[model samples]
Target: MVRWVRALVVGAALAGMITLAGVVLGRIYADPLLVRLVAGAAIGSVGLSVGMRRLPNWTVAPLSATVLGAYTIVGLKLAAGQADVTGPLSQIARDSLVNGIPRLLTAMIPVQPAPDTVVVPVIAAWLAGLAAAEVAVRARRVLLGLLPVVALYAGALYVVGPNASAAGWTTPAFAGLAIVALATSARPAHAEVPEVSAKLRGRAMAGAAAGLVAVIALGAAVGPWVGGQVSASPVDPRRYVQPPQVDSLDESPLNRISGWALSPEQRLFEVSPTGAKSRTVRLRLAVLPDYDGITWRVGATYRNAGRVLPQLPRLPDATTADVRQEIVIDGLTGRLLPVVPTPTEITGARIAFDAATGTLIRPEQLSTGLRYSVVSEVQTPDVNLLPAADVPSGNAVARFLAVGPGVPERIQRLADQLADGNGAAFDRATAIEEFLAEHYRKVADAPSGHAYPNLDFFLFGPRAQGGQVGTSEQFAASFALLARLTGLPSRVVVGFDAPAGGGAVTAGNAIAWPEVLFNDLGWVAFDPMPKSKNPRPVEEDFTPKPTKPPTPPSEPPTSADTSSSSAPPAALAAATDGGPGAAVIAGGASGSVVLLLAGLALALVVMRRGLSRRRLTVGTPDERIGGAWAELRDALRLSGRPLPAHLAATEAAAYAKEPSAVRIRRAAPASEAAPLPPLDELVAGINTVGFAPGAADDAQADRAGSQAVAYATALRARRSWWRRVWWSLHPGPLRWRRPL
Candidate 1:
């Protein structure tokens, strides 16, 4: 019992020592600190179990557990920086009073994100220690010898700095406790025969010590290797805004202004009329009241510009058609633009632009381009109505209607000359539209600057200038303003005029027309342009030109086969016939199948060979028992006494009446014994040949060979019923089979 206890202690101590070595080596390799610590604890526990025979059982368990726990704490500290902040612990403590507590808790949870580096090693050490303690207690040992030394080491650590050296002290303290318990409970020697030989005891102790050292070395080596392969690299650190510049122009006030420049390339307006050819439309143009510098500033107004008078009865309803048109502009850089309808009160207006352009178009300077759309009602006017007794005041359009420039004066003068009396609003409006159409000529260019002040430049300027026409937008504005001045309610309508091509016309092809409002009818559109020889309709569709397809190149012809005939006939034939393109494919497939089959056959052969070798190498007590058993089995089979199935060599020997069996059992160093006939002599001879620091001579080798052969021959001789039975039971011939 004492010997067994010693053996167990030695094993446990050896396991612990090995673990410590591994941890130290691992640290040197820059392994994760946690990994190193855990590995160290585990190796220590293993070494203690397998190597340290003198270590007490009670000491092993607590010591191993404490070492492992310390390792775990160290590993955690090393890997703490890499833990995820949003993990379980973090989530739980997200709203907690103490920050990071939840994160710490989550990291401690096992197998969530991934296992900790120290987990395996720590667990291993703890388990090993536990097992060692249980084994020692079961063996009923007392008084562990190493307890005092461990306690001293732990006390020294505590004296240095209790809190700071907690990890260093914990392992030694546990080891001390384990050793004390084991030593106090250690069993006394028996009064009868000695349970263990001094030589055997010494060897066991030495092996345990060696194993402990091995474990410690292994732990040190493994720890650093694991750490380096696992951990993430470290973040870079930016300014927010730039400094402002001086003397920048003030653009805030521009937001309220409606006026915007239409570069030469910009489409000012678009016009599309139902069932009307897209011919050039002559119209009037005008600007609202505003101050002018290099450009006009038309302010946006919250006031309703075209509200109907309350005093006047509503005019009779007229069937009016609503025309839809798209207006596109060019050379516009910024996003937002102002859109206003002429003769106002017109709704159903919507504008769209690229999604990238948000609601606001900033830096309202000349560089910020603008575009919008307008919808207006147009219809023919009724030719009868009485003039109002008094026009409303504070109405800009009403005032303009009473005595505006251009067509108003001409209409009044013509009415006085023709009727010899004042004309009503309906009659005046009709006469003005006809007179203007007859008088004005549509041209591409009109007067600019002060030359076109009011409507005089467009209506009564020089004949050469009169024939010149500006954009449809200019024409429509001029006409609408003139009509309003002449007591005719009118407004300009801007929309797209489809071209003759068969495709959709965009805002890029915009045109404008005037709509005159007469009492009892509605607004009516009129074109004042002169007829041209090659006029194109505005509403015709335009189709895009078709694209051409690319052509393919012709393939070059293949050259005739050519080859020398000196090669093998089959090779020569293959070369002349485009090589082995098809045959090679077939051969490759066949070869692959053959290789696969051959590999499987080889594996089976190797497995069979291994099994046979294993069977042959049984029933031997020495370290190389496999080889001895093979020779013994062959020798027994030839003796004719069949060996019983599943019987141990000891039982078989007892039945054989061999005196050598007793000596075999008594051999102290079993590794030096040879299992064959004349077992006593063989065992003694082999013991003499035990491992030592010396070279072998030729005479020694011959003598050893001769002895081995003689023993084999004696085992083969059938002398008794037991021997004959063993021989008969065992197979005779030794067959050598080659590996597949």
Candidate 2:
């Protein structure tokens, strides 16, 4: 009875721990089926392992494996709707083994509860329960049994990353169960404790009570400090793993803008509101952020995603409302999926989404009649914040500021002239819009080209030279480049301006526009298209409101005039107008600067690593001990804390109390950054080698180096992430004027 009761306690505790660990998968998976599968696996594995405890240990493992295999196979098979015995059970099991792990890692959060997705969590729970049960019941090692459960829990947390955190009760619940198992296994099954003398028992009880009290007091003193010092931003493990690449993303959807314009009356896609009220919905198909003088393309990494998309890092001061649209593809042909900006949820089709660009793509090509529903978090910026908004510096948004080579001098000067009086980024953007709308003509049949030459002709070339007329393609491309020249981060969005209340979207509704990034207002859209004076031609393409035709340039260029311009020296053109040779020289210089910086950083790291290695290995025992202390001081220097050459080891460690050093003396307010006692002990060893010892042995030297390495590691870990990166790259320690 006593053995049976002990087994029951072990089984119950292991089951609780395994189940709790499995439930952490809720962060990544939304399906209730996953929770149920994990729970069943945990309970079954624990029960079977405990029941077969009387059997030989080797046999018990085989039995547990057989049981788990059968359970997992049947569960997966039934979930896949292939319950027939004659069906491909072996292949189902094989695919699950082969593809399951990768699927879990790459699948988007709130993952669909499919057979492959559920297999990993179910197997994990069963193995944890089985291994934990065997150790606790047969081996009689309760605390050791907690290893599998702890490993499972940690793996789940890492896989979830910053997606979601476990609930409040989970930590306490696991801790409580672990304690119960430890207490139950403290004594032998069916054995009685020998009675102790009253005096001895009293002393033992008091000692236990005192130890418990000390632990409680320590926790109370340190808990809040530890919590406060933890980084506000959790390190996301997924960043280290590369997102799966798609080949379809290479084909720029911006190229389709021309084709859509050519067939204006053709139906493209239709949008219907899922909500009661209907409003105008502007769907963005793709964002073109990269241009290479030839064509524009998307510069975003699309990852496989589920219904709930990742949240943005910062939410500007804006009124955000959820707008749901049921969209149907009509004649739109491409892999790119049109979506309202900042989609929160998508259903009815599989997709790869880029959160940064708010773009979506169907890995599978879109066909006529394909349907999907999207819930978008539409933001309306606070208008009052617009005027005060400042554009980010060029360094901060270099990608958007980038323009290809061979930009005309006239274009740059024109951008400067138009933006000269505008004090704010928004004002400059608006100035460009007002100038374009007032001066340019927007013809429906304007030839499609957005290259430098095309825009050059549109802006400055004489009308007799086929200049000054084009579509939204020209208007938007020109505006975006000009905005970038004026120091505003800008990107062109290609999509359709669907009718208000959402119905049939035709190619005639297609439009492209430029958006400028503002500090507090986010990407604000600007209209540079000239207003249409002509009434809409029913069943035809939408034409922008036309302005009076732009005046011809003062002097129409003749062949003689062209020849005069071309007569300039190639070197002069390169110097004056940013020609091919200038571009090459500029690129080469920039590349050289980057290489120099990288080489400097590599040199610093190599020198620091070599210095520490030589300190431990190459020097005499006594000298090595001294080198260890030097290495510790070097690490401290990396943190930007000064340690004077005259100071003793102990004095130096104490004086180096810059917040991240985990100071030995309590100079700061009570927090997690309190003194490190290990540093004091290491300092004592340094003092002994330098002052008291005649000679230090090899073991003593090795120990000193090891301890110094540890202390330095802890000091480095306490600093912020960017500071740590700088600490590795800094040459301050290597260049110290005088080594201590």
- Best-fitting candidate, scored by lDDT: 2
lDDT of candidate 2 over 435-533, digit per residue (tens): 677667777777777888888888876655556667888889989988876667899999887765768999878888999887767788999998755
* Whole-model lDDT, model 2: 0.74
TM-score of decoy 1: 0.24
Alpha carbon RMSD to native, model 1: 47.9
Best by TM-score: 2
TM-score for each model? 0.24, 0.60
Task: Count backbone clashes in candidate 1.
Answer: 109
> Residue-wise lDDT of candidate 1 within 80-136, one digit each (tens)?
333321234333222222322222122211111112323433454446444543454
Clashing residue pairs in candidate 2 are 531-545, 531-546, 532-544, 532-545, 532-546
Query: Candidates' lDDT values, in order?
Result: 0.37, 0.74
Q: Go through the candidates in order and give the C-alpha RMSD of each one to the true structure.
A: 47.9, 22.9
Worst 10 residues of 2 by lDDT: 535-544
